[model samples]
Target: MKPLLRLVEEIRHGIPSHYHVDLENRLAIAWGERKRKRFDIKPRSRGENLVATRENRARIIYLQAQDEDCLLFLAFILAYSPRSCVDFKTTEFVEFHDYALDNIQQRASPETEKLLKTMAIRRGFNQNLHYLNYMQTMFPKGIREQEPIGETLVSTAAESVGNEMRIDEIGRDDRGRQIERMYSNGPISQVSMFGELLSNAIQSSHQWRKERGLGESTTNCWTTMIPRDPNEDISITIWLGRRDGHRVNTALMVEPTWSSPSLPMPE
Candidate 1:
């Protein structure tokens, strides 16, 4: 199947009757804007080649009608291969869209329906996280976890390991002193257990970073605190890169003030 056709099928399944060729350019524009980047679509001298390429690609568009308001959108799901590009056919495209629509309708409760329009935005974030995870697994060494203060967790962990490897000089430095304290407090020699925990945390953190759009930056930081008490299950905070200062400030400054005071919080 063509990549565009697969995308179309996915979109149809996810979004239903909202697909149209006329809206392809607009959909592409919308995608680029949301990503804050321009898509590289080759310019064609004639419409035939453009249409042919689009048809061969795994893409799906749907015209969503809710009362009077209609929304036309397309989704492209392409997986680049080393040898060649595998595209999705029209049937695959439509099937994917149908799947998407069914998934959406399954969650069409009164409360969820109120947020239905925002589903595409959420889906984009989810897809980004999926891609990030795949990339992390492929290039584990390049995946660095930064602490809140902007130090690499992997480097810190390595230094800690080095210090632990020297058991004779246990209390030589602050790190060694901390290790001594841990050794006295509990079963701290379980290196394998710690490795497993750290590995899981790294994977989870990578997914979190992608979901938050942190990208590949040394300065970005993400933290999550889970209290022992049941009152606070999870608390998350993110610090963006210095280059993203404008975006970070804008997000922080706009959020508290923009929320609807009268709207009930979700359960």
Candidate 2:
């Protein structure tokens, strides 16, 4: 039998009778058909040092039981790993399964858990790298700069310095140390003034889609903001479409698509 089919069967057997499967979306939804009952399933402690180290590591696993997608299992695992230090190799699915089993059995050694976490983190980072590389290919060069406005600010400041200010003399003092003085008639603003200017610039550039046409149809519009500092720049992208699905569209506003290896960062 196919792996997905096998998984579905196992899930059907393992899950409580209160849950129903949404075959169209391949999602399982839990319902309150049965009287409320709570099982005494003791929570397992991973241990202090282990948990602390796990927190510091970059591997992560994000799972949503509400989603019928099989990839949710993998997503859950990746969400738990530390940031920036783990790798998951796509070709090594067997290794991933083994590690997952070990993790569930509580038989995973500290070292083994650490290694698995590292692999998961690396996997996520590599996936992001691949996505960024693809985007780089799609977008031509010079479409955007790392710090567009920052470069402008620095260049403007440098150009204005000599032309706007004068350094007339440098003379030796009584102790033979050189003395220098400069004068400027250029405009200077307090930090708050600069901040206000930046805020206004961003607000002005923001775009909002206004309703057009009749019926129950609506769309969204987007705008770009220019930052005063190169490092502080930001851009917002929006997708607008009619919503026709039941599941919560936490990430994508449209219908849920197939699980891709490179998921976009959560907003």
Name the best candidate (by TM-score): 2
TM-score of 2: 0.18
lDDT comparing candidate 2 with the true structure: 0.25
lDDT of 2 by residue, 1-267 (tens): 144334433442233222222211111101111112234596434564444433323222221211112222423332223332234333233333322222232121333222322332333221121112211212212112211232222221111133121112332222233323212211122212324433233222211111121111211122222233355434432222223112224433575445423344334
Model 1: per-residue Cα lDDT over 1-267, one tens digit each: 355445544543344334332233333322322221224595445554544444333122211111001111223322222112123222333333333322322212232221221332333321122222222222223222212222211121111121111112122221112122111111223222424534234333322233223233321123223333355344433322223444445645644433222233422
Off by over 4 Å in 2: 1-8, 12-47, 55-58, 61-232, 235-267
In terms of TM-score, how similar is model 1 to the real structure? Answer: 0.17
TM-scores for candidates 1 onward, in order: 0.17, 0.18
Question: lDDT of all predictions, in order shown?
Answer: 0.28, 0.25
